[model samples]
Target: MSEVRVILHTDKRQALLREAQAEIRENQGRIPAGDFYARKLSAAWRRARGTRAYGPGEDQDDIGEFSLERFRDLPVTPRESLKAQPLRYAAVTPTEASEYYETTGTTGQPTPTPRLAEDTIWNTVSVAEAWRPLLGADERVVILLPSDVVPVADLVSGVCEYLDLAHIRAYPFATGITGWDRLEAMWRTFRPTTVFVAPGVALQFTRLLAQRGQLDELSSSVDRLACSGGGYTYTAAAGPGPSAARVGLARRTQGRPALPGGEASPGGRHCLHRPHRRTRAGRPG
Candidate 1:
């Protein structure tokens, strides 16, 4: 098994590192060992370290002698820096590349992130490992998200493929209310044990389905509901209320609780606010 550990100032980083380490140890000897993402990050860290030197002779000294204090003094690389040197920034060559992903660029320009082939494989493996406990061997899964292939959807699809589960489906809903009827049709036909959705579309679908008394149609087959694409607020901007409320509705209808640590917006009605009990009560079982 390959093991990769990341250390950051935050506890969240530490916890993630531990989880990754545990995953590595769990699969040790079965795969190449080491953090692929960390390797890329470490390369960036080295570049940051090298740029911090002040004295004339500092350039000639071995990296081992490079002071940690100087490294700490290095200016952080901005998104533009990564964008400026995408090729140099990569830890591994394309030969080891399995997939390419991009930031949605909602804030600014999108940045393309490349994944090493092994990292992609391990990612699917990790997901399968986590999901195996929750999902049964015979359970069916349907992925309903954007048409454009995103990393999260790709990961979910790849994991389903790896598991060789009996039924796995993908229906592209894109953004907004563009494909509600099509999505509804697929929902009826697939009757999946799992359903994944983009945040905005998930919310819209939840509202529409609830209004039409069709929410239970989805809940009947889908026990697990997964969503991604920013927080509920960002998602809500694309349509109605926060994505979390939509997620909560999906979970409640399906008889499950929402996943923790999802993004939130204070005083945001559509993204983070819980649905009104009256609204939920009026919905059909």
Candidate 2:
């Protein structure tokens, strides 16, 4: 018989585990009840509690009173645990699971998350409902995020499909049109009324188009500019810092004001600039 020994680098390992556990707790409440991912999480919690037992040398009298509450109080759903026992935690049967998305764990392990068909539709419908006010029924939306291969991309595409909008274009950040000319061509060809882009990409586009003197052309056709993923600050390119003039230029050219502190009209067409704070993640633009 051979025996294997395991050693723990106490300080580093404990710190990493603490951080991962905190993240799991923060994300737990936000998980949608109907989601297969959430159901899997519930199952994982149950299994972890069920298998935990007191050591043999432990007091016999305390055995019955010893509750799983102590173990449950400690975070048990770290990404590592999910990765180690994926099948045990999965809510959907193998035959029923259609989509699998993986998140990189703290230790660089891939944690697989299952998704059902109805979960896809529900997510799509939710996104469409949230953005419908900003995007009119006749408008076309250009998705300037990553390609629709990942979960985020799939959700965006699904939302657009559910909306029944005529045009939905996706430009991959990696290989799609980079220059102003190419971008302008795509924008014109697609004739998108609504442009959905991340704040970082939008800022880069603003800088590039401004330099090329093509900012107006891009902004002219876009009725609504939806800033997805994150927010930005509208500051001047030169002179007395982020002056009202420069900020206005950036906002007008970008077709949407900088998020967080900016205000939008009730109808959702026009944006009003004000002293505002940055918008939080998962918040509507």
Candidate 3:
């Protein structure tokens, strides 16, 4: 019998459903892409309108006229780019934040990303809904990402806790707080059913295992391997990035672009152990 007892709080449920509904309606042509997008930006910008990031009412009125080019003038910036001074992008103060998590500093010195208490609450509920159908209580999970200060991934941990699933942590690798061999040993001992890791880290470990002639050590129990850092849906040339890791794949239609050959299909069901050629610190943008 399945032991999963997933329960979403009403506020969190409504928030997530709202986002999903909006996305579905937009994709189904019920909402005009440009005008609806402008309104969304206008709403978010309106929230952050009086912050240091936006610089006191600058670009306030032009929110409804938003265009793709308007991205250059938006008050928001990617968290990675603002890592050097993370709080500068925040609308709230440190006292209001619940915790802070730092990047692995693979490119340079680490940058800290802070989150409020409400952020964690929303995300915890969000992950439970998004991942519940794909995960089972009987399964064990191995998370290959940092968790000391509770980043977004921590919300997944919350789901694990709720479902009473065994979740093994391989955190220190991202921060160099621990080493690769330790992680390899844990994989051998735990044999996790689900593995969550960034794509770059996954490739790096693959190379290490292949060089050590231990490719077969990869767990067969794993039915789901979620690679984080999915990155931009659209590329710089205005093309979609490689859909190598779509977990909850969008609706498929004739005109819609299907995932390229050799990618994880819908349902998070996947096969691991294919050797990737590149070795990098973490997933690239």
Cα lDDT of model 1 overall?
0.49
Number of clashing pairs per prediction, in order: 8, 2, 0
Q: Write the per-residue lDDT of candidate 1 for residues 1-285, one digit (tens) a residue.
A: 111221134576456545654765576446544665455455445543433232224444333334446556656657577777655455444465545666552235555666654455446556555555556787677666555445665666665665677544454454464367877787687677665565655666677876676665455555555655433322111122233235443222122213322211111111222223223344322
Give the alpha-carbon lDDT of every model.
0.49, 0.46, 0.49
Winner on TM-score (1 vs 3) = 1
Error of 1 at 122 (Å): 1.6
Candidate 3 Cα outliers beyond 4 Å, as residue runs:
1-43, 55-86, 103-105, 108-112, 146-152, 172-178, 230-285
- Candidate 3 lDDT over 167-248, as tens digits, reads 8667645556557888878788888777766555565665566566554446345556655433211211101222222223
What's the C-alpha lDDT at position 209 in model 2?
Answer: 62
Query: Considering summed lDDT, which 10 consecutive residues are worst modelled in model 1?
Result: 262-271
lDDT of 3: 0.49
Local accuracy of candidate 2 as per-residue lDDT tens digits, 157-218: 55566567765555545564454456667876877766665445555665666666655555
TM-score of each: 0.57, 0.50, 0.55
Model 1 clash pairs are 1-28, 1-29, 2-33, 3-34, 232-243, 241-270, 242-270, 242-271
